[model samples]
Target: MRVPVVVKVGLFALAVMGIYTYYANSIPQIQSALPEEISLEAETVTPEQLVRVGEELFKGKGTCEVCHRIGQVGARAPDLAGIGGRAGTRRPGVSPTAYLVESLLQPGAYVVEGFPNIMPRVDRPPIGLNRSELWAVVAFLESLGGEVRARLDDIPKTAGVPAGEAPVAELKLPGDPEAGKAIFMGKGGCVACHKAGPLGASPVGPDLSEIAKIQTPEYIMAKILNPAAMGTVAGYPAGVMPPTLGQTLTAKEYVDLVSFLLTLKGGA
Candidate 1:
């Protein structure tokens, strides 16, 4: 069928416009609407300059490496490998940036479960950090996941003891499994580890819901009170566990903690 020239051209134009509209609509609207992840590349500062300024306060004035590790081998501090992703999940009620800032400024608030609350609160005098220096350490910690892109020169190279030096003796404290749960979740902060059925636990540390099935109450008590004696595993970091919890806890608290820990069971 021979169509009129003007009509033919009009139909062709309409078909083109319709095809354009269909394809446009078919494109994912969310992709177009969503914002790209902005690169947080540092401003143009020399690598040496960044390290000097960053490490000066961090390792020297700040003394971060005293407890924290950069390359997975320091004493009493959770290794900072993949900490940029972990800090958010490990400690609830904290984002990556906010968690980093809060940790530096207030070290004891939400401790890395199983570790002692020994990290003196940085908010107090004689050991406080101003805002900028704290953030710089955060930036450096956030940067440590991959190859250490920054020069950690200021971080002293002294080799720390492979494991914590705390002595490990039989747990003298006595408590029941039922009672231990109370002290654990309440006083001893045992909920930080030993999760079962979504009750209380943290992945950065060990799970104790099945300890009773595996180890005796005395063994469990000794291990809990003296984590250094227990040693390390794949997920759990070594030496970071506080071996002095026995000293800090009362006999009753110890009993209660041990009692609660024994309640953990495998296979539900």
Candidate 2:
């Protein structure tokens, strides 16, 4: 998808990650960094220490920066530069701490404008952050533009996997990306509406040049089969993409399409 012009913010916001620097010479290294279980079990961990660990979790295990960045106007999620202060005002009568906690634990409770309500709950499986980890992440976010007053008790101990939720990210299908590109530009008719970098420029759908960066592989797979259930991008009409994609494409074609989409993390 096409990323909008990024409005540069403060130094904190301008801390563009080394690997994500666009149009660079070297190719990026793509590999899985499984969630490393961090045990912050002691209550004696300082607020400053928690903030440090939270920063690590956000960048690494939490995989937050894949969708959110500090300075840039986020395409998938909200710009978290001054979120420490902006969060309190997100919902009336909602404290900054409460807002952050609810946003992470229950993302759909309050969706930001222009962004879809596709945020998966951070406390669930796959991204299961323990109670203390939740406290640390919230503390780290609070430190962004406000005072760090989040105590360990701010996060609920019962926050865990729902009864029926599955680990969607674990599903792996090695589809040929080259074959998928063909399906996208020709057979799949994706290029008719969507913009895949310089491949197409139809305003009918959102630019998908960076879909992999902002979304998960499973989401892209499911969206093709059922666009309505995945939710639509803001400013775009819903029910436009064909709902019969699953029935229309052969199993090989579907796999190839997802493989191609997964490689769209910007041409750099």
Candidate 3:
């Protein structure tokens, strides 16, 4: 049977369209339905008030948008879209908001899986945050995580000590921003994943444009040593960040590395 050329063309086009639609929608839907075996407490906030406050805090003084991604703008970090979902499977027993608080206060405590542990410690900066500012930043991060699968309430609010309060620092190495840059790229191994100015690092992680202004030293160190402990925050996959490479360095090295990290502050 000789089919008309137009008929054959039309059928081919329809088949192609059908395949595209199925791949685009159905695959995702089925994957969503599949059991990922995740465990994460959902987040709860004041809604409009928290979101508005978080938006301003994140974009403004927080300067989180510089390295981290929110609703467009910056890059060098993972997209915040559906952070709640990512955290659930990746960080079991961790709340999205709590995870954010930990990340800000201790960037090194729990490095995301698959990514290099490169986020400089926030402690390098002298900007010690008061209680209110800390809460505000945490709130903003939680908002980004959005409503998770399990109710956040299910997870204990006090999963760990409040961020920015840990006495993790023992040595006193006066930080030099200039020297810190060298240490970051050199011994610290931070240059492997983080980019600074013309010095480009790997895209597998976030950038260090103006991290000093956004994070506290305590937060930075925690992220360095144990990012998994921080869980998932700002929707970055908790498992994505590696644990702090503390075992790799000595006490003095830790102090020196931290001092160098502090100099990375100020707007990029």
Per-model CA lDDT versus the true structure: 0.49, 0.71, 0.50
Once fitted onto the true fold, the runs of candidate 1 whose alpha carbons sit more than 4 angstroms away are 1-52, 146-268
Whose lDDT is higher: candidate 2's or candidate 3's?
2
Best by TM-score: 2
Model 2 worst lDDT run, 10 consecutive residues: 5-14
Report the lDDT tens digits of candidate 3 across residue range 1-268: 9976545543543453355445533322111111112111223444455456546656654555665675563454556665544554545786666666556656666776644444543223333333344454455555555562222343334332233343333223344456556667777677887776556667655565555455445556556666666444442445666554655544445555666665555443
lDDT of 1 by residue, 1-268 (tens): 8865545533443453355345433431211111212111335654444435555555654545555666676355677768766766756676666666566555667767656544543322222333334444666665555222422222222211111222222222234766666776766765665465456757656555444433334345446556665545444567766666655666556556655664554455
**Model 3's TM-score against the true structure:** 0.40
Q: What is candidate 2's lDDT per residue for 1-268, written digit by digit as tens?
A: 7532222211212232222233121321222333455667655888899999999989866768757888886245677998889889989999999999999988989988777788767764335566777888999999999989898777776764322333333333467889999999998999999988778989788788867655655467667877888888656788899887666676677777878887786655
TM-score of 1: 0.35
Q: Give each model's clash number.
A: 11, 4, 40
Off by over 4 Å in 2: 1-35, 160-186, 189-218, 234-244, 251-268
Better of 1 and 2 by lDDT: 2
What TM-score goes with each of the models?
0.35, 0.62, 0.40
